[model samples]
Target chain A: MAQTSTLDRGGATPSAPARRPTAPRRSRGLPAWAVPYALLLPGLLVIGGLLLYPLYQMVEMSFYKVGLRQIRPNPRPAEFLGAGNYTEVFRSELFWSSLRNTVVFAAVTVALTLLAGTLVGLLLHRLGRAMSTFVVVGIMAAWATPPTATAVIWKWLFDADAGVVNWALGLLPGPLSELIFGTSDWSGRPWLNSPATIYLVLVVAVVWASFPFIAVSVLAGLKSIPSELYEAARVDGSGPVTTFWKITFPLLRPVFSVLLVLSVIWDFKVFTQLYVLAGGTTNREAFNLSLWAYTEAFSAPPKMGFGAAIAVVLTLILLVITGVYVRQIVRTEDVR
Target chain B: MEHVSRVLTRGIAGHSVWRYLLNSAVVALGTVLAGSVVALLAATAVARFRFRFRTTFLILLLIVQMIPAEALLIPLFLMVRRLGLYDQLLGLVVVNVGFTLPFAIWMLRTFVAAVPKELEEAAAIDGAGRLVTFWRVLFPLVAPGLVATSIFSFITAWNEFVFALTLINDQGGYTMPVALGFFTSQRSTDWGGIMAASTLMTIPVIVFFLLVQRRMVSGLVAGAVKG
Candidate 1:
């Protein structure tokens, strides 16, 4: 019932042949069975070679001691170090803290993004058409802004000196500002200096950039539900809260689940924004798994195998998180 | 405003900035063109045919999509180097294509399914060969979805920072995002110039997003609903 199908049919009508003759499917140079395989060959090669093979390589490298020398064109033999890299990663305090950062950030971001996004989606559903379009356009701009630009803009906003955040805080009543920060003077207060404050800024930036897609998606889901359900609930004397819990939430559960999983996957691996906010590996305290892996592998004195171990650990965690959802999707989809 | 404009002018007029912008554009365009073809073909196969391993392929696409690109970074970096594509734009393009293909194929499958199979059947009945029917009937119908996927691919490639940062070490090969990162990390940072450059980088993505957002949303919803 989506607009895309209607659009596709309408677009195809011009070129679609009118006469319906009765002829069987013909096998020309290629057999009918071979056609799909032919089409899929290029994609299979790319995915197999680039994605799957690298995944195997990452796991394989984790079991060996790969270094810059081992990975060079004229490579040295990598020594097998069964579980050595993993033991190094597991014992390291940095890995534990980075894992905590990754998990906590993802948990907080996924929850807040869903809450804000669903609220905006409901608001959009209730608004007038013109106003809905206006708000959607505004939200779309936020969603479409590149992650790097988003991080930079937020960084500038929270800059210690001459930032709008401090300026606005200073404008508050002296007593209020004093109560909040223990001083009315808000200038030269570094927001990105500490891991806590850095993550606060990051949470704000990430949630701002991400919620729009969820909002738009939830809005589309909302539109698909029959209004008659709401009407029937109204007739049954259901309160707005009851109606939402009983009807809206249940109807949109599938959409919500998909969005939640996708958000978790994205937020857990947040690198670019953290890279910008933490200003590279300088503030090791703010490192997430993605950034930690990158720094470990690529920075001076590269520990390629150690980084691969971290990445493998991260991937395993994500797989555990999404395994059930993937199973459910495969079960529901009639891919026979 | 005048001071801001001066800083913006300085930022926008840098030769290195132009090179970065061009690099970004080339990589993004290459991803779009190459990704669309690969995805479109794969999507058609998954949607239209009941081949062996079809379900497994679908599952693989989902699994690949879920894996963080960062996880593959080290090995892919090595792979690119082994293939003599390191520090090259072609290498970046190939990486982007690989990363973007899973989502594109997954999303485009829904678009392909949205086109009624009867059209192809009708074309076949009219003595049109399989290639003819696919080219004449299926491709046009899938074009809108292709646009949506291309836009997604373009934006993803444009904004990609990590792979580009790690893969291409040469200053001349740096993309816009990498250039912007370098700009921010400088000791004497030009805030106004950085802000201006960031805004410049964001404009194209926003414009394209706004143009097709409605269709894209519906397309996304359709996919989610079907799944």
Candidate 2:
């Protein structure tokens, strides 16, 4: 009764009802159904206008043969050709190489990030509080860095002439350097000179940039597990690896699932770092799906329609692969 | 780090790094403010009130998170140009806010829900108005979550490259990340300049992360775990 009276207190007290939170007023205000929608209007407008509408436009453009001339205020009109762009893309060697590179890059980076993250997460769980906080903060500094900056740092650190990485390699004996890298000198060995080596630096930079988030997330997941489970495993004399697989792995399934899907999406579409490392669209052979799409759309003599087609295909591929995870996330949200 | 500061201070391509930093600040701060306001209102509505299609709204947010910014670049370019915001910092701000809104709302919803419902009632019982109650009681409690979400939005805008690269064409309009691209080219190399500028770009992000990282852990987990 008291709650109802206060909630229903009329608009008579103008000052006190400053923001009469369109709260539950079964008596005679706006319908309850309208409130959430009203509040959500701004967000809905932005998403609908910016995200959904553009996506629709992207899909529409994919069916046409539009380019720089077509996109101009006054120019040649675009011609709709159901799948001509897709056919051209499939036939192009550039597309195949980008697809192959993207797949390989995503596969390797996801695996390394998960493995390293989980192990670090476990280490964080086992460590004393101060030490764990110290290590987690240290790694997060890397994750917090902008992607372009990370690429530049790694590129400079691996510079052929005056880089610290090569300088460190020089400190090793000639025979050791030869045995390890199949080379006697690190000088003038361009990390960015070829597709294979650019990916090496790229993989290192991305993994270093990405793993900290996974590790922190895994740490958060680890903290949620009851120590009793670990204690029980210890009493059962289970080995470290055994305990990990039998106990920890089962406990962190959800976190791992979420991380796996997110990492795949992130790595598959990785653009900035790769763009910086490859030194722009200059190196066509090293493009990933995202970069290839960008270069196609915005590069010289922009093939806007063709670029839209690539983006659509990439989205489709991502949808097919990650559709389950997306559904899972939606399902989790449905619980409320 | 020293080299990075030197390059940034000396300027790049005859353009002052400070100018680019100011542009980035405008976009990032604008995103944080605009994204947070809309997200907070929506989050409060979702968390505190029962409404039709609530589940659908939440689900839509998750789907939006999955869509890559690159996929929407083509039409967005047209949209921005048509809106007469082309080559403007405000355009970048709006797009960043749109991209970051779903995330900010989702993360903040959990924090909003964490605030005790009883407190709001207590404040109202004291003859406080709805807005007053929220400001005096709710805002202080939810500030951590707000800070966390705002930081994420800020970083998203600050480091965004693809949209910044595509939307603005003028050399003077460059954001820091896009500006870094100018130092490298096909025929020439400027390792010192690139390294110096890159390090300067990274410092602010790290500083901000350190400030709210503790909340971010819980904030991240909350978004993932909560329905």
Candidate 3:
């Protein structure tokens, strides 16, 4: 009876040694969901305190009659001008023109980037490994260059006088005099002064600076595709174009969509390129929303409230685009 | 040989090349170092701890990232001015760290999490302390992540222009971006010089990426596909 009792206790794990095994596991505690949140609190607080507060202040400023004068002590209360600033902004012809320009710029830039990126990605897919590596390096190099530097380089190249572009144009088959010194002499035609020309120049500069990023991202997407798909397609006697259209394109659609949405948001808020290229002045016709906001805030009399309103609008636009994109990304992730 | 000769003749050279190289190196290195420290700490915390508001923090980070650098210029400028850091490398570093911290942390977190918990547990069983376990046993496993995140931070800080333009005023303190701006305003806007400057600016980034591109590619693929 004593032997049987000892054996049962050892087997059933009612003794101290049996409990010891479970103690370590219990000591670690549950996979506490709260712990992750606690860890995240500090970062969240910092972002909220710094970024979100300023954003809130901007929103508050937009609804009031605030300006350069308001930066100092004033007797007059910041008048609760409900949507007055928004109304003024919406009614302004400059505002409308700038809005149109912004839309056009974002659309064109995103379209060009996606198309160029996709083509480059396809090329990388088809090319030999050595060549692909070389191209990838080149693309990364371009992507990594300072935007301001690229802007400067592009502006120099497009300069009317003693510019490399003009010099090259002088060599092309044409009336050399006409090409270099046209009826409207190249030097006389200020590229930055004309609204249409300035827009084109800005587009070119932005495209050159941004396309490399899209290319790299697309390349990443391309690399994920299994090689067997290509083999399967080839066995079915599908041409290269058809194979890409059916097999590769479908697989890459998710990444392409995400890239498209991100590029749109990014392009819409582009300020430096426009600011540098335009020399931080409104051309009336060429100005975009970002430049418009900057001008409103920093120009004479300094309508900080109006500027804030414009920024608010821009933020809302970005938020809406991001929301849609995030939903799509989340849905795709869930499905997978 | 003709192409080489043409490039040499037409490229930005002489005194400007040295200046450009110096400016870019200073800004890139300073920003990268500052940004990496913040990223490393934040990423480790996020990976190791399970606290309340973790999801909110992640979401907030994504949102903040969408708030284009352009939008932050006014606030950042005001803050910098108030802090008396205007036109300084320290100021640039602060802003670069702020701008880069979110993405760096996000990227680094994945790497930190990729490390097996059992390794740390085994180290603990061997009487190693938490810090010792982290530093000695787990650090090497996430070395690739560190490289990847650092590359990102370096690239971003190096390429930054808007805030640098708005914040930096003194030519003596100018970074590459600001220097490029000055180059733009100089008489004649030398195309060759500008191109040469740009080409030079692009080189270090290219080299860095080349060195780590394989690791980055594999890391990204593993994280996205496998996760």
Query: Could you tell me the C-alpha RMSD of candidate 3 in Å?
Result: 6.8
Native-referenced DockQ of model 2: 0.53
TM-score per model over all chains = 0.92, 0.92, 0.82
Interface RMSD of 3: 7.3
Chain B alone vs. reference chain B, TM-score for every model: 0.92, 0.94, 0.85
Off by over 4 Å in 2: A1-29, A175-184, A330-334, B1-5, B124-129, B186-189, B225-227
Question: What's the lDDT of the predicted structure labeled candidate 2?
Answer: 0.82
**Which residue pairs in candidate 2 have backbone atoms (N, alpha carbon, C) closer than 3 angstroms, thus clashing?**
B4-B196
> Quick one: RMSD of model 1?
4.9
Model 2 chain B: worst 10 consecutive residues (lDDT sum):
B183-192
Which number leads on DockQ?
1
Clashes of each: 0, 1, 12
The per-residue C-alpha lDDT of model 1 at residue A101 equals 93
TM-score of chain B of 3: 0.85
Which tens-of-lDDT digit does each residue in A60-134 have in candidate 2? Answer: 999898887787877787898999998988888988999999999999999999988888888888899999989
Better of 1 and 2 by DockQ: 1
Which lDDT tens digits does candidate 1 get at residues A1-336? 111233335434544445323123342257657878999999999999889999999999999988878977679999999999999998999998998999899999999999999999999999999999999889978987888999998999999885899888767677875778787566778998999999999999999999988898889889989999999999999998999899999988877888888889889989999999888888999999989999999998898999999999999998887786686676656655
Worst 10 residues of 1 chain B by lDDT: B7-16
Q: CA lDDT of A285 in candidate 3? A: 70
lDDT of 3 by residue, A184-284 (tens): 33343456767777777888888877776677677777778889989999999999889978988898887777778878988998877776677666566
